[model samples]
Target: MYASFFGLSQDPFSIAPDPRYLFMSERHREALAHLLYGLGGGGGFVLLTGEIGTGKTTVCRCFLEQIPADCNVAYIFNPKLTVGELLQSVCDEFGIPHGHNGPGEETAKDCIDPLNAFLLRTHAAGQHNVLIIDEAQNLSADVLEQLRLLTNLETNERKLLQIILIGQPELRTLLARPELEQLAQRVIARFHLDALSLAETEHYIAHRLAIGGRHGALPFDRAALQLVHRMTHGVPRRINLLCGRALLGAYATGQSVVDRKIVAKAGTEVFGDLPAARSAGHPKAVAAGLGLVAGVALLAGLGWAMGVKLPWTGASPTAASSAAGPHIAAARPAASQASAALAATATAAATDHFADLFTTLPRAEDAAWRALAADWKATPDAAADPCEALPAQGLQCFRSTRTSLALIRQLDRPGLLTLTDAQGRPAYALLRGLDARNATLLVNGQPRAVPLATLALYWRGEYATLWRTPPLDDRLKGEKARAAATAQWVSQQLATLPGVATPASGAAAGDSPRERIYRFQLAQGLVPDGQAGPITLMLLNRATGVAEPQLQK
Candidate 1:
């Protein structure tokens, strides 16, 4: 109900385990890497445990999507079962004909025999089998032992079945039991996922909002965002609950922006008795009155009298210009001098360019996307979202907040810029061209070159762009195997860079590939996490001259 009011396409904070909404924070990437590492560990238990609602299941779902076609998977979400019942469920999942009445009517042998036969047959046919048990902490000791025995089915090489146990932190405690030592010993890989850090929480919120089609600036202010992390303790589920309720409250109060007071009130409603921030004690009536006056002043000062009509609202101009006149007079120089050097160079040429841009600005966000598509020389389906459609042509959409022009220059790619217009409304322009002095932006299907200083005045640096991923090799499906291959690839690419010594006995000589990647990331002004995630890979592709589009000079 509040989605449209907030300029969102859908509810951003739904609790559903949607992989598309997953935020790949550093910890989440590490968690996913561990799961992938287990896939190539030659058939053993891969354990992933986290607190409830920490996103283990969501990560697993993403892992499932990347599973190789040659692997067969059986997923069991409910593990509170007897050995016979579990075997039966496994049989049901794999569509094996395990006949015998219910649990009491069958010996464990009856189910194991057919499963073993199936595994051996599939193994002989060069197929791998994976069994994933969620909520495995509830598994009876006997059932877990039975699962361990299933791993015993083997050829001369590796075990026939690979089992992954995912559950809450209690699962780790359960595995630490004396009797379960053998099972714990067989776990070739393990990772414990922790709650999001404060920075990650902020990114997580922005990620969901972007995915949910939020246009313009965020509704919550920076202080409120920080407060959200504090109130939710960085747990995703709690964040979702509080943020969803906060948006609803803002809508009910007829407010566009969600300030600290709104968030505190929402937190109180969601988690009883949480005190509001000290500065939030002002009565709502006075705040609303001030907000109304501020609103009129802002709109009246928009300079829309330049003949650009309000497209979204179609409301007539308010006659509050008398009150707004002085405010606009006082703010112009502050807005214009966002950069002293750029402001100094902002001559009539740049002013004329901006005027034409405002008069012909495209209102819908999709127009910016279409402009970006044209940069790649690709056509997207008219009825489909461009981001979703372009993937078929091997492109993926990446969005980031709190970004800077230097980072954009380093990436060296054409992208969309979310700019605030004279009306203080969110406006998107296709950034097809860039240079030190001016940026060439595509607005309303026309190109305009505006001085960078003038550009800085309207843009707060929210950017969305597309990157092309190179075709994958056969090693794409297996986690550890792929990591090794990727490391080798990274080494080869680094060798081609100027002044870099040849990678000599790197991993064997303590200068590991991860360390090299970290150094390379630091040099490239990236996060330096030592993981070759999408951004890192994209830079590699660019440096290596992969046949992708580059930003216009």
Candidate 2:
């Protein structure tokens, strides 16, 4: 109807699997070509898989049409059958008569014997037999094994029965199971159909319109076409659904061309409240509309995005962009420039690359904590949170952003360096010793003296430094008591600082004490290194305008 309204001879965007509208993109051609090549060779399992609605079935149909006239096909569309039933179905599809054995007497082996006889008889007659199982992912392990064993019916040179498996992505995973190792090894060739790219998608739509006899300007405008791609992710079925609906929408509105707004409204009907659509439609709507609540969600989302598992949240770590991390909106140009200069100086100091003797440690975070324990003369759990665990040893973990090795050495303490590997995996290295040109690092408990340039190459200019908090009193027996007294004073001082949000009643001064400490350090013209040192503490005390510094040396 949309095609006719647009002066097309046929509904080009119909969701039905019509070979007339089968636009073969490069990927589709390759997938089809690969499958066809497998069919020509001696009998072995040929596998084809793809995500939902990527035209796997269409490609298979096209290939089947092009197959040699002498080839015999036993195509199974629905494979949800028991082992005996599956074998019987295969024989039935191949026109092989099964023995009329008594009830409950005909076994899977009984069906296989006749199929094997048929395959052997066909091979002698100079004809090829191919068994194609569609939706093979639904086939149970035992049923699949029955299929594999059927391949044993072979002649002197090649398999008498050629097998092909086609399904969704689940089919690929199903074949990869350890129990299917035998079947997997018999696979001669495999190909996965993928969705079209943006350019290919544009071509696909145009080609279909041309096929429908409407070659000129399409009803979908440029923005409308782009939105269709975003909404459908180049999935053919989804594209059809959206484009068809958008055309109807345009016709109903008495509009000549479909626009992005129409496509968006169509998408709402096709896919309700898609997350990607929301993010793309309004980048800052959530943050701006909800205000403070949005900030909390943003922070939580950031944490999850960074693959940082919060001990309290019990949420699994999620993969994110390599550059993804917590966003800091505050200005820190001095820190940025200083880090750049340090990186340059560090690179220039090493005239030659040192021998790479570093071995990646088994546990990166653990290695950093181990190095800190060595520096502070305290036993720390490898898995414990440094921020929480260090306090029990009368110490605290402070994070700082710094680039200068000299400043890090001036503090004369081991710290954890956050860096990215070549592949962009987050890595940790403990800065144990800092020399002029080389630095000793404990990478997961392995020791090495690497060039500062080597460290600078991967360092993210972020590190964690440990600080020993002076005991509150001589007779503070309980760790909780000491921590309470320290938290009370720190919270009070943090509350007094300008722009620092006060915590709830009976809560600590700042929600994230480390963040508060960083703000304080920056306000005092400190490095904002996120480390608590004598100088940062002194500056923080002065800015808090509090009596007697509670954080002692």
Residue-level error in angstroms, candidate 1, position 257? 1.1
Which 10-residue span in candidate 1 carries the lowest summed lDDT?
A: 313-322
Error of 2 at 240 (Å): 0.4
Clashes of 1: 0
lDDT of each: 0.72, 0.64
lDDT of 1 by residue, 422-528 (tens): 67877788887887556888765667777664565577669998888555475476877766766777788877775333332322244566656655554554545
- Candidate 2 ranges with C-alpha deviation above 4 Å: 101-104, 279-553
Tell me the tens digit of each residue's lDDT in model 2 across 153-258. 7778788888889999998888889999999988876778889777667657766766677623455656777888888999888888877776655433323456
Per-prediction TM-score to the true structure, in the order listed = 0.58, 0.50
Instruction: Pull out the clashing pairs in model 1.
Output: none
What stretches of model 1 exceed 4 Å from their correct place? Answer: 100-104, 275-553
Residue 226 in model 2: lDDT: 84
Error of 1 at 500 (Å): 20
In angstroms, the error of model 1 at 393 is 29
